[model samples]
Target: MLRRNVRLRREYLYRKSLEGKERLLYEKKRKIRQALEEGKPIPTELRNEEKALRSEIDLEDDQTAVPKSSIDDEYANASERDPKILLSTSRNPSSRLTQFVKELKFVFPNAQRINRGGQVISEIVEACRSHEFTDIVMVHEHRGEPDGLIVCHLPFGPTAYFGLHNVVTRHDIKDKKAVGTMSEAYPHLILHNFSTKLGERTSNILKYLFPVPKPDSKRIITFANQSDYISFRHHVYEKPGGPKSIELKEVGPRFELRLYQIKLGTLDQTEVQNEWVIRPYMNTTKKQKILGA
Candidate 1:
């Protein structure tokens, strides 16, 4: 009887230990799933434990839940139907940005202004998603020019923050109708990646918001490369086969977008912008090797 009692107590203790282990694992998975759904970057400690959990658990994963990494990766897509743009700024309204946001409204009729309200990019991203905003165009101001523009697509993104150069408007241009027609064409695009492979990838991104002119028409857009500061050829070009000529009249909306943060192909600019800023003092020298942009 004494031996039997001892054996029974040992088994009870072992069973309790097993239950505790299972409970801890359940919490880990719950945390991982929550973090992934919120688009939080998983902590390295949690990531390591996740590897360990994979080996410890042999049962098939819960059918309703996906791997944490897969859920995190889903943010790379722009899942919305229409491009509902939200214009935002980080600092308090610097008059210039305020004015641009206002003009941007007339230019992009549906584009609406959202106050920063001391919230960080992560919160802004979540807010945009909750409000069903499809894209975000954030203006970064310095001196007089709205020198930086960040574009983020929601619910999963290809976010781009560009260093703007030579911004122009209809009032500033000689041919106002030429610029007006570009907008009227509805989804006209001029994207240059400086090289072919990069251009194709970048074009897909701009296409999500500004889809190609449906069936093609005569609206003009001008995009230049990283090295080319001399001239921007503005015209409508013939398709690859036919005449292979361009109607080069040399007039269009004047603007230049040089890529500053290429990570927009995958990550959220709202989230990443927290760690970056435009350093006018740094200029083009050390600025070439960016820590974060």
Candidate 2:
């Protein structure tokens, strides 16, 4: 098993590394094909390889017309099965943090929360992998307040770290009447203002956490991006009078997440490269949005 895993990892890395070259070749073929269709001369930069590109284009079918991306490999089989998530807290979590994790368990369907007593990060990751969990979410607290969250995809990872702020748990909601009952139904997702490339990447990281919901599912979860901060909201809507008269109720435990770092490897790996990291001190324009256009 270990040998097979190492070989598979090597193959995956090799394919990922070749994406740039494959993309360049695809562009060359596209340019040559376009020039031929328009009866125009091929661009000077691609003239040398026009013959080869034209031949490849002729052999291309519908599936080969567009080059595949490495991102597709990361979650190629994601839709085939629902996500199984393992939720855990930092060691010796406070009561408040424990409550927050309990609330999170309901927030994500098919999630199981486990005690972090004496278990290290590596051990937790290994156990989740062995159990075929799709993702592992670890919440950290500062002074008894949940302040950080880590999401690591199983087997291989593109782990994302977010700083949690303004967390309001279900029990913390002052008005008990307004809080909607937590539903176990799969919730529909609404991803708003994730416009840029990085924003799209971040959105995918959050999107695959939930399985596909049915069309009739009234429960909705929204991840709205504003000024690079993602506001997480959960709600269940109803048609009290009719389709024309709709009512929406906010479920408790809303929070804001600011992405800080994305690592190419899982939580247990220390030497892997970081896909992206926020650099707050870098000199740039004051009004810049990393997660939105």
Candidate 3:
């Protein structure tokens, strides 16, 4: 039954890929057909382009078409699926994922470090079922620092990959009071002075982290910003003015996190098909190394 489910998912991915390719071809053909009806000269290059796209799609289909035997073998070869993860960096020496994973274990003891080697996304995500991993933190390499972060939750997820800089942990924080709050209080997310595109990516991350509660639930989620830094303060407060809302006097766990990294965007695909944002895209503004670096 597990194998059947995995097979279905792979089929869905292939169909989605094909759809993207088909949409591009359809747009091109529609433009060409419109030109013909209007008696405009269609460029020969476009004709060549259409042919090339068709050929490419056909080639991709042939190359990626999964066999039933391979599907079974994938599950069979899966080493182990457990919430205890095998964290490691890509083979790049500059990668900090290995180091990050080391530090992370203290905070999230569920993770286990594996030697850095060649591991792709398909195997990791697939292993989620076969190996039973609850999460995968894949950090990709960049020139100065390993800035790409791919956080995949299993058996399914809000799998997010994004570029971040100035990443640090609680140990790095001098003010222990910085650890904010995680109470019965609905989470409030804020984004400060993020560029338009970056803001969208951060917003997506916030949504994933603090999804909306059920309609009837009174879980409070707030969004308030203070210039450059995001502040999340959770407390139940009452409105004597109109409604009968009151503040929850009983406080909860405090969680204060400091993230200096400017969110670039969703970590995009790199040479490693499963790895995201190993290479940055152009046009968007990028951060320079911090003053000390």
Candidate 4:
């Protein structure tokens, strides 16, 4: 099993490294095809390769016309299988953090929470990987308040680290009447204002955490991006009269997530390159948005 895993990882990395060349070739083919269709001379730079590109284009069909990115491989089979998530907290977590983790367990449909105990991150990651867990979510707290969240995708990862803020768990909600009952059904997702490339990448990381919801599922989970802070909300709706008379209820445990970094490797890998990271002190406009336009 170990040998097979290593070989597979090597193959995956090689394929990813070739994506740039594949994209370039795809552009060349596109340019030649466009010039031919418009009855114009081929672009000067592409003229020498026109014959080869044209022949390749002739052999291509609808599916081969577009190039696929390496990013797509990360969650290629995500839709085919229900996401199995492992939720845990930092070692010797506080009572408040424990309760927050419990609330999170119910938030994700197939998630299972385990006591962190004295286990290290590497051990936890290996155990989850062996168990075929799709993703791992670890929450950290500072002075009994949940302040950090790490989401690591298994087998291969693009782990995302977020700083938690304004966390309001279900137990903390004093107004009992306003809180909606937690539903175990898979919730439909609403991702709003994720317009930029980084925004879309971040959106994909969060979106695959939940399995595909049934069309009629009343539970709704939303991740809305504004000024780079992602606001997470949970809710359930009811149509007492009809579709026109729909009523919405807010579920507790809402929070804001500010992404700090995204690593191309899993949580346990210390030497991996960072896919993206926030550098707040760098020279830039104060109003610049990283997650949206």
Candidate 5:
């Protein structure tokens, strides 16, 4: 009876040890597969263990760890979140493509770089619509590298000249009506990059292309009403010797036009005067309101 008891205990211990070993092997396999699919280097010990396991276990049965399936899942999730950039290898399919993709991933951590089909442009358009990206930045290299183009064939419209940088310009209700058509909004000037000199030239170009509105008395009144009040002294002298030399004559309640100075496109002298006449109207209104009979 003593011998039989010892034998049963030993068998039970042996079975428990085997079960523990199988559990360890399964865990190691899972970790190694995860690292591989993520393009991470596996550790030496783990790699060796994986090799041995491959010889013993049928890899075909481990369909849960397929790299392609993992990539597809990642892409689907990324597409649902942000703009998707599909990199086309057709333009230049080289090993460098991998590094380029990695660089793009680094720049836009949320973006995914997928191998594109022949319909790359359409894919880009769809991505823009789904993701609602304001603008597209494309890296172009004529030396057989991939070039990202504005997908929808939509024009980039006129850029505002800020003297130091080109900014996007928007059309107002009046401006849109004056334009009369979408074709008129197409970019008349192309700037390769943002530069100070380019901005000056762009300003000049915009001024040349668009008709500048002349500012009148009504415009001045409207402009003044929208701005902070500023009082400036003006001489109301009749002539050189017509009346006693007027000194410190108050003439205006001009708006602080300097504060509201806009640099887009160009402005004429009349516009500038209209922009500055707020203070005079303000002064007159104050005089009437306070010193009325």
Candidate 6:
């Protein structure tokens, strides 16, 4: 049954990918048709310009380079005395992610670290239920991807100040679930592929990179595509307000939400995919003496 389920999921993903591709091509053709109908002449100069842009895009897609960081300076720059920043990561920490920790420690000085799979989900949920964390500040790398992970989710109201992360899951979660008073939704953050500052740098550095645009307005498009006569519909909303009655403008199909910010609009696809920012939301005048600060 498990094998069958996996096969079914693979099939569904394959079909979804093909449908998305077809819809993209159709949209491109539709835009071109609209331009022609608007009495816009397809100038030879414009054609040349488009060709040049396409060439650049193609070149970016072709180039693959691993980003470089000064690993030797990581430990030297950061002593053990920094306040810790917590974010989730796969159980097996990647070299790039460790390097990020090193750099974050160097910059912050009192850097504490939390792995994503340290605590059980139930325990973490219980902690939130109590007054453990009132304010949660998430500082994440803005990767231009559809499914960016979140570093923090604070309880509603104040006094819940426990930084409980390294939370684990036995299965992949894509839907929303009720976790105490708030719903622990999956994919807390989503950003667009071309909407990141790093995306601009990436596009500039790699000639063939095709960056997706950040939606001019914030709205979710329901009923945008139909495949095999099956229609999929859902509402995407603005965050911090939680699931309230909020209306936003519709964007392109590639857009996905990540935590509070739309994915590509906030995060960039760097070598380190799981790096995140975390801090307690507090207004204390008395400076907490951090371990290494």
Best by TM-score: 4
Off by over 4 Å in 2: 43-49, 178-181, 281-287
> Which candidate has the highest lDDT of all?
4
Off by over 4 Å in 6: 1-85, 105-111, 125-149, 157-293
Q: Write model 3 residue lDDT over 207-292, tens digit each, in one string.
A: 34333334443334342332323333333334556566554421221132223343211122232233123233432335431111
lDDT of 5 by residue, 1-293 (tens): 34653575466446544655656767777777678789998867776577786655555465543323211221233223323333333344454434444443432223445554454543554454345442232323334443322111111111121111111112212233222221211111222222333233322322232222233211111111111221111112123454465332212211121111222211111221121112345446443221112
Report each candidate's C-alpha RMSD, comma-separated, in the order given.
15.4, 2.2, 11.7, 2.0, 30.7, 21.7
Q: Residue 267 in model 4: shift from native, Å? A: 0.9
lDDT of 6 by residue, 1-293 (tens): 34653575466445534655655544444444456679775545346455544454344432221122222112222222321233334344555444444332322212244564576543443343343332122222323211233323222111111122221111112333311121112111221243344333222221111122245323222311111011212234554566575644222112222122211111111222222222243123342211111
- Clashing residue pairs, backbone N/CA/C < 3 A, model 1: 75-156
Q: After superposition, how far is residue 165 of candidate 6 from its true place, in Å?
A: 23
Could you tell me every candidate's TM-score relative to the true structure?
A: 0.50, 0.91, 0.39, 0.92, 0.22, 0.20
Model 2 compared with the native: what TM-score? 0.91
Candidate 3 TM-score, true structure as reference: 0.39
- List ranges where model 5 is wrong by over 4 Å: 1-92, 135-293
Position 154, candidate 1: lDDT: 58
Error of 3 at 184 (Å): 3.6
- Per-model tally of clashing residue pairs: 1, 0, 21, 0, 9, 52
TM-score of 5: 0.22
Pairs in steric clash, model 5: 252-280, 253-278, 253-279, 253-280, 254-278, 254-279, 254-280, 255-278, 255-279
Total clashes for model 2: 0
| 1-293: candidate 1 lDDT, tens digit per residue | 34653575466446544655656667777776677789997667788687665554445457523333321332344433446778887578776567666655544425778788788876766667767777778878777677777777655455666776776644456755444333344434465443444454445545555433566665455444554221223444345456665544433434666554544222343333232334566457654433221
